[model samples]
Target: MTVVHVLLGLGWWLVAPRGAQGVPRPFLSLHPSREVTLGDTVTLRCRVPHPNVPVSIYEEDGEPKWQWDRVEDTAEVSVNVVTRDFAGRYRCQYNMTALSRFLRVSNPVELVVLDPNFPPPVMSLSPGGRVKPGTDVTVSCWSTYGATFLLHKAGISAPIQRQSLSRGNTATFTLYGVTQSDVGTYGCSYHPRGNPFVSSHPRSEVTLELEEGGPSMDHPVSQQPAPRPSLSLHPSEEVALGDNVTFRCHVPRKGVRVIVYKEGDGNYRWQQDGVQDTTEVSMQASTNEISGRYRCRYEILAPTWATDWSDPVEMVVLDASFPPPTLSLSPRGHVETGTNVTICCRSPHGATFVLYKAGTSDPIQRIVTGNTVAFTLHGVTQADTGTYGCSYRPQENPFISSPIGTSMTIPWHRDTFP
Candidate 1:
C-alpha cells in the first residue's frame, strides 16, 4: 500500500499540467494610480489566451468585499463615483483548474476628483447695507445649490467663523463688536463632498463708520464765530519716525488766502499757500528736528484782518533709520514635544507685522499695530522651530525696508544623556 501511494503522488506532480507561467496580459488598463475623489468610476479587464473561458471578477479592499463573479469572455469591473476611502490599487487574475495565474498588474489607476467648484458661496450683510461702528450686524451666506458654508471676515485672512447646513438655502453670520476698521467686504463659500462641482457668487459689500462719544450725528452745532488769522506751530508731539503724520487747520471757506508757516526761531518759514478751503495737510517727516506744533490762519487780501489762528496740532518726528523689529522666542532654546512658547516682536515704527514659518508662504500670525507694535504667540510647539523675520512699510511712500532680523530653530525632542 505504501508503494502504491508513492506512485500516485509522483503521478499527481508529473501529470498535472504546470500552472500558467510568464506575465499574463491585461486586456484593458487604467492610466493613473489610486487616489480618486468622491465621485468617479474605474474599469478593469483581463486578457484571455483562448476565447470563451469562465472569467470571474473580484475587487480587493472594496466595500462589501466581493462582487458576483462575472463569467464573460473578458472580465470587466466598474467602480462608481468614489469617496476618500475608495482610493487603492486593483488587479485581476484568471482562475485555472490546476492553478491560478496573475494577469499583468494593471497600472495603478489614480482618480482625483477635485471640488470642481469655483468662487465660493455668496455672503451678504443685512440691512444689506453699512453698519455704524459699535453697532451689531448680521451677515448671511446662501448657496443657490448645496449647503455647508464658511465665512471669512475682511482684513482677517482666515475664516473667523463657520456655520453648518440648515434647512433652507441660506446660513447667517453675525458680528456683535463691529468697528470702523471692519468696514470692508466679506466672502463665503461651500464645501460639499457629493456633487462637489458647484459654487455660488459673492455677495455685495457693507461699510461701517465709527462715532466717538455718541454717534457723530448727535453732536450740537458750534455757536462761536470762527477765528483763524495767522499760522503758527502747535506744540510738537513726539512721533516715531516712518509714521504718517497729518497737519490740520481751520481756514475760512470764502475769500480766504491760506499760507502754511513752519515755526522757526526769529523768522517764521513760509511754505505753500492756497485759496481752496483746506483743513488738513499730510507729510512724512524724516527726523526729530523737523518736529514742532503747527497752527494755521487765513487773511482776505493784503489789508483785510486775519482771523485767529486755529488750534495747534502737535507733531514730533523721531529717527527713521532704526533697524527693523526683532522677533524673539520665549523660553529660549529647544521646545519639547507639546510644550508651549511665545513669539514676540518689538518694533519702534510699523503699521502691521506678519510672522511666517520658514519655507511656508502664508503667515502663521499677523498683528496690526496702529499704536501697539508687538506680536505674541500663545503656545509654541515642536513645529514652531524655524527661521522668523518681518517686513515693514513706513507711513508714507519712498521705501519699504527688506525683511529684517535672523532665523532661529527650535527642536521638539531632546536627546537623553546616558
Candidate 2:
C-alpha cells in the first residue's frame, strides 16, 4: 500500500505518491494546468504511454469522468467554459483490456475552477508555470497597484493565502505551493494602506488548475495599460468666498473609481459610492484653501489598474481673509493734542483697506491696494478720541471682507493755560 496524506497549513495540502525513486507510475497530469477563470477555455491533457492501451479518466475511484478506446499516447479533454462545480480532484488509468497484462491507475490531479465576481488578475509562473509533483511552484499575482492581497481556492471559507504589499511602486503577490488544495480559483484585492474597510470596488480573480499524475503548472502575472480620469471645479475656473462649490471627477468610462485631490499639506480624504460616470463633490468656499489647483484620477478594481492624473484645474478663491487686517496706531500709547496719530492697516492677501471710526457707517478713508493702508488724524483732539477700526477686501471679490480690526485710543489733553 502506498502511503499518501498531508499536513495542512496556510498552503494547500495534497496526498503524495509512495512510488519508489526511479520507478515510473502512470499518474495523471495536465497541460498548461487546468486552472481557469469563469468563461475561459481550458484543455486537460491525459498522457498514456506506449504498448498500445485504452485509457480511462475519473474524478475519483469508481467515479468515471471520461474514457478513451485504444488511444495512442495523449488525449486532450476540453472544457468550453469553467464553472465552480467543475472543481475536483481527477485521475486517469489505462489497460483493463486483455491485450495488456496489468491494469494501472494514475495519481490524482485537482481541477480547481475559479469565477470572479470582480475582475480577474493576471497570473504568472516563476521558473516557468509548470512543475513536477513534490517540486515547489510559484504563483505570482500581478496588477497595476494594490495594497494588501488575498488568495482564495475552491471550497475554502477563509483565505487560503494572504500577502502584504511591497513598495518600490509595485502591486504584486506571490503564493507558493503545489498541492490539491492549491488547485482552484485564486483572487485578490487591494485598498489604500491603513484603510481596511474600503477595498477596491472590483476584485482581481485568477484560477489555477492542477495537473494530474506527474508535474504541476502555473502562470505569470499580466500587466495592462492604466487609464486617466479628468477633473474640474463646477463653475470651473474660480470660486467666490462663502459660495457653494463643487469638485467633479470625470472618467472616460463608467464603473471605475475616481479620486479627487486638492493640494493639501495635511488632508484627510473622502469617498463617494455608486459612481456611474462622474463623481460630484461639493463644499463651501469659505477657507483660504478654496482657491488653488485641483486634479483627479481613477482606478479599476478587477484589473487592479490606475490612470494617470488628470490635467490640473486651477481654483481662485475670492476673499480669503481669515486672520483679518491688523490695525495699529503710530502714537500707540497716549496721543497728545496737536500731534499726528497715524492708523495703519495691513493684511497679507487683502485687496482693499478701509478705516472706520466708531458710531459711523461711512469709512473715514478707503484705499485700493493689496498692501498696507494708512490714515493720519492730524492734530489729534478730544473729538478724535473715538474707537477706530480697519477692514480689508481680498482679491477684489464682491461681498468678501475681513473682520473689523478695532483699536482704542485716548488723547492726552494739552491745555493752553495751565
Candidate 3:
C-alpha cells in the first residue's frame, strides 16, 4: 500500500516513497488551522508515510525550527505553548531506507499567532528638514508597552543600536554630522523590557535626504550664487496623493526662516513664516492642488534679504480619478493544480502596477512598464489560492497607491479525472 495526502500550500502530488510496501508518504500538518493564540497548543503531525522513518522539520526558508525522533509509523511534534516566534512557515521530510529514496518533503505551512498587548511601535524623524552634510539628525522610536527599542538602517544586519527607553517609553537615536553615506531607509522595532524574548513588529520606514548643493531656480538645488538656501522634495520629484509629502528649503548658514512656494506664469504658491531652526513642513495633497511645480527659499533675519528660490520640483500624482486597474485570471473561473495560470492586470492610464494577495501587505510582484502587467504563476497549488487584487500608480508617484478596485478568486485546486 502507498500513502498519498495533501500538504499545506502544495498544489500537486509529490513523489511518494517509491516501491515501498504499505509505506505512508510523510506530510507536515498543523492542528490549529487558522491561528495559535497565546497559550494555545499547536500540534505538528509528520505521518511517516513509510512504516518507520526518522523525520525532521524546518521553518521559514530552511531555518531549523523543530524536529522529531525516528518513528516507525508516525511522529507527533507538539508545541505546548506557542509564542510570536512560532508564527511562520514550516516544512518537513522523512527517509525510507528500503527504496533508496530520500524522505518526501512536505510543502510549507504558515502559522499565525496574534498578540494584542504589544503592538508595533511608531518611528519619527525629527527636525525633518533638508538635511545638509555635517547636519545632525534624530530618529525616535516610541511605544506604549515595550521598554527596549531597536533601530535598523537599510544594510546593517544587526540593529544599528539597541537602547532602553529610560524616558517614558521613548527612545531617541541621534546621528551626528550625517553624510551622504547616512542616506538610506531606516526603521525601528520594540521588544518588551522584561520578556526580552518577544518582539513587536517593526514600524514603517523613513529616509534621510542629501544633495551636493542647494536647490536653484527651475533646478533641484540652487545654481544662481552663494549665500542662498536650496529647496527639494523629501522623496523624488514625484509624490503620491494622500501621502505626507514634505518640501524643505535650507541654507548652510543656520538661523533663517524658510518659505516654500509654487512658481508659475505670473502666479505662485508658498508657506507661512515665524518658524525658526531646521523645521519640516508637511502638507496634505489634494487631487486638484497636486498638479504643477514647487520651490522654496530661506530668509536671514536682521539683514532681511531672501535667498534665490531653489529650482522647482515637480510633484506628480497617481490621480485617483484615473480608472483603477483590472485583475483577471487565465482560464476564466475555476482552476486546477499543475495548471500554469496567468494573472493579468491592465490600465489604460497607469504607468506601473502592483499585484497583492489577500492577507499580505507587500505586493507579490511589481511591474514597471506599459499599461499591461502580467505575473505568470507556475503550477499554482493550495498556497496560491486566495483573493488577489492589483493597483496601479503613476510610476513617478508610486508612493500614492491607487485604492484597490478589483479582486479575483483562486479556488482550491481539486484533483479531477477527465
Quick one: best lDDT, which candidate?
A: 3
Which model is ahead, 1 or 3, in terms of lDDT?
A: 3
- Greater-lDDT candidate between 1 and 2: 2
Which tens-of-lDDT digit does each residue in 23-76 have in candidate 1?
354443442323233465655555555444445433322312332243446665
Error of 2 at 190 (Å): 13
Q: Write the per-residue lDDT of candidate 2 for residues 1-418, one digit (tens) a residue.
A: 0011111221221111222222234657765554555566767667766545777776531245677877788766877654455655566766534322234546666654444543434565554544433344555655454444555544444444444443532333333223333445655554333332223434555565544653223221112324557777777454557788888887877787666654321152345545778988898877755555466666554533345456666665545335667666676554444466676677786655656665544454555555777766544433344456676656433234564343444434333101
TM-score of each: 0.24, 0.27, 0.32
Angstrom error of the Cα, residue 376, model 1: value is 40
Task: State which candidate, 2 or 3, has the greater lDDT.
Answer: 3
Residue-pair clashes, model 3: 19
Compared with the true structure, all predictions reach lDDT values of 0.43, 0.52, 0.57
Q: For candidate 3, lDDT tens digit of each residue in 1-418?
A: 0011223223442322345434444677778653455677888776665556667776533334565556776676778555576655566766555544333556556564545556778778866856766565788877887666767777654455555443487777765445444567888777565343356653547887765562222332222433645666676444556666777766666656666654321133454555554456667666535544555666544433355445555565545666677666676555665566676777776655665565554455455557887766544444344556667755334334455464444444344311
Candidates' RMSD to native: 26.9, 36.6, 20.6
Q: Which ten residues in a row have the lowest lDDT in candidate 2?
A: 1-10
Provide the clashing-pair count of each candidate structure.
21, 22, 19
